[model samples]
Target: MTDAGVIDDYVTGLRRVLRGPRGPKIDLVAEARDSLLDAAEALEHGGLDRAGAERAAVEGFGSIGEVAPDYQETLSVPAGRRPAALLFVSVPLTTLLWSLIWRVFPTGPAAHAAWPGWFVPVARGLDILQMLVGVIGGVALLVLGRGLRRIRRPGTG
Candidate 1:
């Protein structure tokens, strides 16, 4: 195959392996294309025929399978301490706010007497829903924190 054909095949395989935005993928492909062409031109200048130069360029660059994973890792978001810290602070604050609300508006005769008959049930239901949402958020925060820790660990991906 021609140099262009080889580059196209390699880039197609690369695009399939890479994840995320189109812009980054296109940029990476363009970079690879430039490098491959440069390598091929260098080899040709060194007295190799066109076909031989192209082949040598592709071989030296390595196959898509061998290089894609490394590129993907580079593209991945790095785990940071900030997100875990934010979650840790927000989760407890949320729980505290909900607890205060629950305490301030005790579900008792005084509450029912002060508000309409429907108000108590509605308020209780809303409180329960908010609690459930808070719990889910806490769990999500925990999971995110754990994942961040794993990503931050040495010699891990």
Candidate 2:
């Protein structure tokens, strides 16, 4: 059976208010729609017309203000995870790739000739700094990854 305007309006409001990872947001709204449709179908089978069943379904589902926050909160989890996961995988890969590139292909005169006095030490220092930063970043990622599990929800003491 076709949905009534009330169901459409409710779903639209739900979609409008939610914010987070797109995939999970879509899945949550789709699930909510399916549930409401199911409820409306049952109500229709019990003899209510389409409009009446849909109105009842929307009322039973709850208001957008009440429901949307929970959905947005759920979305925040995967949103938070993605950047952490990216950093965990990326930092090492970046360090290794840069090292390989430096070894395989040298740029200009720098590769063939020894650097003059101050330049040599400065270059070596920069290389050391790069490596040090990568190591520190990796350690930080590990600590943060573990700490992410202990994070409090949106609002609480």
Name the candidate that leads on lDDT.
2
**Residue 29's C-alpha lDDT in candidate 2?**
88
Task: For candidate 2, write residues 43-126 as lDDT tens digits.
Answer: 999999989999999999887877776776677677767766766676676678667656665668765475345655655765
Q: For model 1, how big is the CA root-mean-square deviation?
A: 6.9
What are the RMSD figures for all models against the true structure?
A: 6.9, 6.3
lDDT for 86 in candidate 2 is 60
Compared with the true structure, all predictions reach lDDT values of: 0.67, 0.73
Clashes of each: 0, 0
* TM-score (all chains, Cα) for each model: 0.53, 0.61
Q: lDDT by residue for model 1 over 89-156, one digit each (tens)?
A: 76676668667766766677677566556655766765776677577666656645564344432122
